[model samples]
Target: MINLNHLNYCYRSGVNVLHDITAEIEPGIHLLMGENGAGKTTLLHIMAGLRYPRTATECTIDDVSTSLRLPSVLSKVFLLTDDMVFPYPTIAEMERYHAPFYPNFDAALLAENLSEFGINPRDSINNFSLGTRKKAYLAYALALRTDILLLDEPANGLDIDSKTVLLRMLSRNITDNQTVIISTHTIWDFQNLFDGVLVLSQGRLVLAEKVWTIVKSLAFVNSLEPISNALYLTQNMGRFQAIVPNDGTLDTAIDYVLLYTALHSPQQSIITQTVKNAR
Candidate 1:
C-alpha cells in the first residue's frame, strides 16, 4: 500500500498545486480523476519520488519514504508521463539500456505486447507516429512489472483499434501484487478496468474509495425524468441519469461519468455521506 499524510506542494513560482492530501492507495487498478490543473500530474510525480512534497507529515510506499528516492524504493515504482522522450533510436536499444534497471522486466512480454500492437522493435522509434510511440512505451512500461505503475494520459494518442488492444492488454496483464494508477480524461475506454477511484478537486483529495464500496452505497439509474430525491442528476440524450441511495433492492451498473460529475457538483456532500454511512 501507498501511505500519504498531510501532503502539500508548491511550485518554484510560489503557486500551490496540492494541499493537505492524505490517502491510502491499495493494490489494484485505480482511476485518478480531476479537471484541468487539478494537480494530478504533480501528485503522480511526488508518488514516484520524482518531485518531493513541500511539507508532508508522512509519505511512503510500502513504508519506505519516497522523498529519499532510494534505489530500493525507486526500483519498485515506474511513472510513464504523457510527454516521454527517448534518447535511444529504437525500442530494442531502449530496452537494452533501461531494462536492467527494472529487475522484473520481462523481455518476452515486451515482444508479445509489441507484436499485438503491430510495432517493430528494431525500427527507429523517431520514425514512428505518436500513437505507435505511445504503444511502444506502454508495452515497455507493462513489462517492467513494477509494484507501482503510474500512467498519465496513457491513451491520449491511440486510435480506436489501438485503444481496444490497450484495454485487452491491461485486463490480462495486471497482477494482484501490482498497483496501477491511471490518470486520464477518457474514462469510458477503461471503465471496466477500474477497481477503485481517487478524485481530486482544485488542490484537495475529495474522494478515495473502492469501486465495490461505492457500488454498494449508491445506485446509479437512468430514467425518462429526473428523480426528485436523487442526490445528483444530469440530462443526456433525452434521458436522465441520477445517483440515489441504494435501497438494497436496486442492482444497477455504475455510470462512472455520472458518478464523477456528481462528486464535482454541489451534491457531493450528500453522496459522500451516503457512502460513509453505508461503511
Candidate 2:
C-alpha cells in the first residue's frame, strides 16, 4: 500500500503546487486525471522520493517510510516518464548499466517487450524515436514488478499500433499484487481500463473513488435536449454534453466523455444554469 498523509510540495520559487493531499493507493489499477500543471507529476516525484517536499509530509509503502534521504524505499515504486535520461547509451548498455537498481527487475520481461515493440536492445537509445524510447522505458518499468507503478503521460507520442499494444499490456499485465497509478491528460484512453479514478484540481485532491462506485452514481448521457441544469456542463464541436448528477444514488449511469463535453461548453453551461434556476 502507498500511503500519503497531509502531503505538501512546491518548487524553489515558493509556489505551492499541491496542498494537504492524502490518499491510500493499493493493489489496483488507478487513474490520476488532471489538466497540465495540476501538480500530478510533482506529486509522483515526491512519492518516488526523487524530490523532497518543503512542508510536513509522510509517504510510506506498507511499513517502509519514504524520504529524500534514502532511495531504498523507492525500489518498490517504478516511475516512468518521457524524459528517460539514458545518458547517451544503447538500449543494451542501458539495461546492463541501470537494470540492477530495481531488485525485482525482470530481464526476460524487458527483452520480450523490446522485441514486441520492435526495439532492439542492441539499438542505440539516440537512434530510436521518442515513441520507441518511451516504449522501451515502459517495457522496463513493467518488468520491474514493483508494488507501486507511476506512469506520467506514458501514452504520449505512441503510434496507433503501439498504443494498442500498450493498452493490451496494461490490461493484461497488471495483477492483484500490483497497484498502477497513471497520471495523464489522456483519461479517455483509459476508458474502462482503470479500476478507480483520482482527480486533482486547484492544488487539491478533488476526487477519489472506485470507478464502479462513481460510475454507478453519476451519469453521462447524450441528451436529446440541452442539459445545462446539471452541476457541470461541457460542449463539443456542435453537440452539447452534460453529466446528470445523482448525488451518489443509483438513479443514473455516467459516460465520462459526455460529462466532459457538457461541462466544457459555454452555451451549455449557461443554458444548464438557467434551466436549473427555473425549476
Candidate 3:
C-alpha cells in the first residue's frame, strides 16, 4: 500500500539527507533499521506526508501518490513521535476532542488499554509519569485505526513489562488492513516482530527483504578464510563472522545478528547489488 520511487531529499543547508531511494511496501509489520544519522526518521516523516522532498519522489498510497497532505490522506496515516504532550485536556476531554476526527476511534478500546497500563483518565497529563503519557498516546493512536501507523522509536523509555505489553497489544490489536511501520535502532527488541526488514545505510536504501529471504541469501560462518567469496565480515569475541553467498551448496543455518554485523561494518561495507536485489 506504499511506494517510493527515485526519492531524493536534502536540507536547506544543502546537506543531503536521503539519496535516490526506491521502495514498495504492503500491509504488514515492516521494521525500518539504521544507525544514528541514517535518515530513518526523515524517511518516516516524508512517508507520513508531513514533510515534502525538494524534488519529486513519487510516493503513492493505494495507487495514489499526489494528494498526500489532504485530511483524507492524513486520516489514513498516523505518525507517533516521542513528543506527545497530551495537550491541555484531561483524558475525558481529550477523547471528546479527537472523537470526530477519527471515524474508527474506539473509546472502549482506549479505556481498556489505559486500564491495562494502570492509568487513570481523571489525572492530569502533566502529573502523570513519562511512561504513562506514552501509554496514553499509544492507546489513542491504536484507537484511531489508521491504515498506516508510523512509530518512531516506539519501544524507548518504557519499562520492560510495558514493552512486553506494547508488543502483545500490537500483536492482538492491529487489523489486517493496517500497515504498521516502526523505525528504531535497537533491533533486538523486535524478536520476530517484523514481517519484512528495511535497512538504510548512508542515507540510501540498502536492503528491503523478508527476514526468511535474508536467512537464505546469507550464511554465517565462524571463519572468513573457509567461506568462498565473502562479501561482508566481522569479528565477534575473537571469532570471525561473515556473510557468504548462499548457492544451496552448504546446509547450515544463517545467524542474522551475525550477518547484520558483517553487512554493516564501517571499514568494509558490502551491501552488494546481488544481495540488495534478493527480494
Candidate 4:
C-alpha cells in the first residue's frame, strides 16, 4: 500500500503546488485526473522519489519513505514520463546498460512487449519518433516488473492502434500484487481500465474513491431537458448529460467527465456531503 499524509510541495519560487494531499492507494490500477497545472505531475514525481516534499509532509510506499531514495526503494518503483531521454542509440544497448538497476527486469518480457508495439528490438532509438519512443519507453517500463509503477501522460504520443495495444498490454500484464498509478488528462482514452479514481483540483485532492462506490453514489443521466435535483449538466447535441444523487434505482455506468464536472461545480459541497454521508 501507498500512504500519503499531509503531503505538500512548493516550487523554488515558493509557490505551492500540492496542498495537504492525503490518500491511501491499494494494489490496483488508479487513474489520477486533473486539469493543466493541477500539480498531478508534481505529485507523481514525489511518489517516484525524484522530488522531496515539505518538512511536515510524509509519503510512503509500504514501510519505506520515498524521500530516502534508497536503492531498495528505487528498485521497487519505476516512473515513466512523457518526455523520455535515451543514452544509447539502440534498444538492445539501452536495455543492456539499464537493466542492472532493476533486479527484476525481464528481458524476455521486454522483447515481447516491443514486438507487440511493432518496435523492433534491434532498431536504433536515436532516430525514433515521439510515438515510437513512447512505445519503447512503455515496453521497458512494464518489463521492469516493479511493485509500484507511475506513468505520466502515457498515451500522449501513441496512435489509435498503438493506444489500443497499450491499454490491452497494461490490463493483461498488471498483477494483483502490483500498484499502478496513471496520471493523464486524456481520461477517455483509458475508458474502463482504472478501478479507482483520484482527482486533484487547484493542488487539492477533490475526490478519491473506488469506481464502484462512486458509481453507486451518483447517477449519470441523459435527457432532453434538465432534471430536478441534478447536481451538474452538460449540453450535447440538443440533449443533456446530467449527474444526480443515486437513489438505489439507477444502475447507470459512471461517466467520469460528468462526475469531474460536478465536483468543480456549485454542487460540490452537496456532493462531498453525500460522499461523507455514505461513509
Residue 223 lDDT in candidate 4: 91
Model 2, 1-279: lDDT tens digits are 877787787778988898888877768988887667878888788778777765434667775666643557777787887674666467677677777787888788788888889888887777778888888778878888787899999999898899888888888778788889998776666677888767676567755666666555555645557885455655667665566554444355446555334333444444234323333
User: What TM-score goes with each of the models?
Assistant: 0.97, 0.84, 0.86, 0.95
- lDDT values of the candidates? 0.90, 0.72, 0.75, 0.87
Cα error, residue 206 of model 4, in Å, equals 0.6
> Runs in model 4 with CA error above 4 Å?
none
Q: How displaced is residue 36 in candidate 1, in Å? A: 0.2
Model 4, 1-279: lDDT tens per residue? 888898999999999999988899988899998888999999989988989886523788886789989898899899998875767777788788987899989899899999999899788887788899999989989999899999999999899999999999999999998989999878888989998889898999988878878777788899998788877777888988888888788899878887787887788778767765655
Residue-level error in angstroms, candidate 2, position 227:
4.1
Candidate 3 lDDT over residue span 158-178, tens digit each: 888888888888888888888
Rank order (by TM-score, best first): 1, 4, 3, 2
TM-score, candidate 1, is: 0.97
* Whole-model lDDT, model 1: 0.90
Model 4, residue 175: C-alpha shift (Å):
0.7
Error of 1 at 152 (Å): 0.5
- Output the better candidate (3/4) by lDDT: 4
